[model samples]
Target: MIDLNKLRTFTVVADEGSITKAAARLYRTQPAISAQLKDVEEETELVLFERKNSKIYLTKEGTCLFEYARERIDEIDGVVACLRNNRQNLDGTIRLGVYFELTSSFVPEIVHAFKREHPRVRLDIIELDHDALEVGLLGNDIDLGLVTTLKKPSFFETQPFYSFQRHLVASREYLSTVSSTLTYENIFDLEVIASSNLLSDYKYWLKINQQNQLLKQVDNITKLITVKDAEALRSLIKKGAGIGFYDDFGGQSKSEDYAVVPVFPESKPITINIDVARRKTRTQNLLQDEFYDFLIEKSEAGLT
Candidate 1:
């Protein structure tokens, strides 16, 4: 059966003509948007798009589906609006800057639940890098920001979002080649995949844990494949594209086809912390304040 949510995503992608643009318009990540489009195509069992010159164009079947999707969307919009009007009247706009990796995390569900209560409220979710997300908060461009960083920022009024451990992850096929009990300089012999930020964070972990000698392993990564987002890194690892660093926030670490292990088993445990934040100087409005409290409540409830 076709999922209307995926179909709606198809219409947005069709209207925008670029997965990146569609992601931005819908406040989602490009990878998440691409995955949704793939699902839509699978459900319909037809290729709905073609790529050329780094852009997406509708196929003949896609064009037909787009027309039907638009009609369904038009009708759904009216029904949704009527339902919202009859729901709680709390109304205000809240702009959120979310870390790119967190786009595929549980944050969206939290936002959706908040929307269910304040149906009239407007939320603008922007996918941003950690640096840009922080800049958005400092500049007052976004009302709230979600980010993953090692040291918690002292300036922002913050609430706990998510905390996780990122470790070396690989396919069972790959791990079997190297000793699963890998340590220290053994990394020099293995092909590794990681983002630049992950490399830096790992280095910091090594230094603080007094394992300075192991720092060379991070630098000696001769066979390295770099990717931008956590999802891409995990996807590549699952396909035997070398080992990458990741947290099982999505709880797929025990994924049947793969193995997740400590990047450095001998080192002290290190954690990646994601936080929900607002500028200390930013004034609290009804919607923003309520959403902030809601996030705290979710954290306490372990809602993820």
Candidate 2:
């Protein structure tokens, strides 16, 4: 039977590129680490590394085994973590990433409730956009991510948290310049300000109204000013730079900031779903599991 300890030592040595460095990292003597690596090579019947000019280098087999060993060790560590966290009293920090929209509106209430319940649990929240959230999840920089999306992300195991309506917003001053009724034709007469990332979302919403073709017309006839992000777009709209969009749930509390007018009564508020997601590799983490449940309960109660 291959020893897990030996495999671990080999992996560390491969990562460090030398037994001396690996020994220091593992808090073991250099001789002990070297012996562990030798034992691993003997058991596996593979020459894992070659030494030249006082430096160690991984062979072809060593590179392949390194990947396998690292995965196995990570899996073992995850299992141990899950077991430890299953205790009656929850403790430990959870790094959470949230989009800007939810940061101000929904997160405060959720955090207050969660902290009240589990006072010992620590939460570190960072505001990030959709792309940054994905990167953070994959890099293990965040334990949980809250984001709004029209399409599902393949990399995460996500649970639906809440559904919010996307509202068309503009300053009352700007709207007064147009006809009393807000229509696609009249609205296009003024400039449109929105996040460039949401242009596709706008296109998708237009398709549902059979006004998908209006996309080209809006692009050609009106001046579309694309901003860097939602915050910037909201700022522009508030300053009466142009018309923009925001989630009704996220912005309703700040409705005084802008006027919400539907171009068409049948206009479906672009239903964007806010979802809580974690890496697919993450499993059985008690804190994450409990927090996820709490979010669901709160969402079901219409707290968000």
How high is each candidate's TM-score?
0.62, 0.59
Span of ten consecutive residues with least summed lDDT in model 2? 256-265
Candidate 1, number of clashes: 0
Task: Please list the C-alpha lDDT of all candidates, in the order they appear.
Answer: 0.78, 0.77
* Clash pairs, model 2 backbone: none
Name model 2 segments beyond 4 Å from true.
1-89, 150-155, 179-186, 217-239, 250-259, 263-266
Candidate 1 lDDT, 1-304, residue by residue in tens = 8888889999999998988899999999999999999998888899999999989899999999999889988999999998656546878788888877667667678878888888888888888877888888888898988777524487688878778766655676766777867766576578777666357766866677787888866766678788777678778887777766666664657564345555565556457787889878876576788778878888787865
TM-score for candidate 2, please give it: 0.59
Worst 10 residues of 1 by lDDT: 256-265
